[model samples]
Target: MPFLTDPVLTAGAFAAVPQPEIPTGDGLLLRPWQASDAPAVYAAFQDPLMHRWQLRAADSAHEVRGWIEEWRGEWATARSVQWAVVDAGEGALLGRVALHHIDLVDGVGEIGYWTVPAARGEGVAARGTSALARWALDEAGFGRLELTHALGNGASCRVAAKCGFALEGTKRSAVLYTDGRQDVHLHARVRGD
Candidate 1:
């Protein structure tokens, strides 16, 4: 009862995805974003660096709260998994890492991250990214994950490298920044790699 071109596939339901708390190196915790963390999220997005790369900007804590709620929806739909990077002792929101563009059937996803200005230069992005990417590939049953950054963003390039993601190639004018279009470097890691 199947078409000749149809490939046999495993069944998956996005609504059944579970969110787990992940611990990272150097006393950092990766967990679901809380309503209370909206203020910190808003503050981090205000950074100049974030503005230069990311397209959306939150103007207030309320908007960030909405963003967090949307992330919860994404989790429920198996569309994406987002984690709030926080300090172990203080529970201070340090950054965020996410596996977006998730395809449950294909077992593939894309990784993205941003660190607060205060947490920059401390390997926070690298550590959190590694933890999240590993979790996606190992525990989450993903076969491949990709991370991309603007070619001019050296810091993000370093983070990807530190997490063992190999440079695949350049995507010409793939990203549109506020200023103009920019070439992006595509980095990826397969489950075994």
Candidate 2:
């Protein structure tokens, strides 16, 4: 059961330490999602745009709490991690940033984020995503990270560019949306870039 190469990251790389809070330098901080934040999470999902891009909608504070629990569990498994992007002073939830589809053996993960209706156009997504990317590629030892979004999602494209994730290519009919299948833009960033 041995491979020719060693894992790029140790299995317990993330689990070995407490999840650190990341500051975006834009009055926002990315912190662990809390059960008490369920109400805010639920409110954000009520936005039509937010619900459209997300894989699932939080119908109630209870569902959001469940999601927070699941997200916390992933940290232990080293499979994925999610953070609540909040106002640094007020601690109000403004958005979310996450690294999913993680592969410790390859040192890669996918980044995803969404901003609340009130936070849109405020650079919340860009700032939060940039902070997470730095942590993932520089601090966390990930060799590569990817950000993908539906072709029509121009805002997301801008966020990727702002965060230094170069557009790799377009994935034809890559994902299904509420509207139907759509082409997706694939962007990526690697260590030292």
Candidate 3:
């Protein structure tokens, strides 16, 4: 069976090239996750806010290494990708940004991000997200990117807005957290926007 429209991006669009490191103008860099980052990632997950929003906490650096391995493997499949947001000067881990749930045929992918406790309030999330969204939508040829966060997360709401992901709508009880189900705000940015 044929479809009415062609895939917005080809299957190997992302896998064809090595994942590139993106520099956020604000002195932050989004780079591929490395095994050496496990300690920082593990420590970041220990923050209460990070633990709460992420819905899981890393028990050990070993576990984080597994995650890094999995994130690296996803690049080969080209279905999902994650980047470690780091300081450009010292390369300290600041946060993470990712394009997940990618659908090449539709040219859409969802964005997810979080900042280390120390990096919060410094605009790391927004800067990193913006850089990745630009790479995904402009350089990588994705037509649209979506960002959804649980309602009442003002920080995340602000990050979404700062990155130009317009609020599309809310999905009631759309996400399950450690506490309970919560409403989710859906934001999006299209290629032209």
Candidate 4:
């Protein structure tokens, strides 16, 4: 009999926890959030492209530190798992990827991510997103993954499509951007056996 067949074990909520590090394509590295990443994350957030494409507004140093603490807590407490993308060759952080909403009972999760400006057009986002989703579905037992983007963010749409996400639909005025309400496209990647 499988451990998954144990009633008591199955009754508890499965968590999207992270080990200190997991391997990327060429590096033996994939780690959860850390306070040290605050600076890099803040710098990445300052990019005009992310601000316009994402709903997040400008964050202060304090906010970035606080965000780091929050993310660390999630990883420590088994709520969510967030990874800082890093250079496989140099071992330097390049971006971030997260299993945002995890519902173990339902076997569903959501993936959100952004790459540093330098990493864009290098397939970093697509590769990182793909690796994270594979981990969730294959190792973490998630049955579904969802991603969304503002309709105007064509790059993100392309990445999602590349990762095998099927466009569910577009909802007008669904996402409230910092500037105003914007249209959103929902994409999903169903698990496969």
Q: Provide TM-scores for the models.
A: 0.92, 0.96, 0.97, 0.85
Instruction: Determine the C-alpha RMSD for candidate 4 after optimal superposition of all C-alphas.
Output: 4.2
Model 4 Cα lDDT, one tens digit per residue, 161-193: 999999999988987887899988999998782
The lDDT of each candidate is 0.87, 0.92, 0.92, 0.77
Worst 10 residues of 4 by lDDT: 5-14
Q: Report, for all candidates in order, the number of backbone clashes.
A: 0, 0, 0, 0
lDDT for 97 (candidate 1):
93
Root-mean-square deviation (CA) per prediction: 2.2, 1.1, 0.9, 4.2
Against the true structure, candidate 4 reaches a TM-score of 0.85
Off by over 4 Å in 3: none
| Candidate 1 lDDT tens digits, 30-69 | 9988999999999988889899988899989999999999
Compute the lDDT for candidate 2.
0.92
Which of candidates 1 and 4 is the stronger one according to lDDT? 1
Judged by TM-score relative to the true structure, which candidate is superior, 2 or 4? 2
Ranking by TM-score: 3, 2, 1, 4
In TM-score terms, candidate 1 sits at 0.92
lDDT of 1 at 160: 95
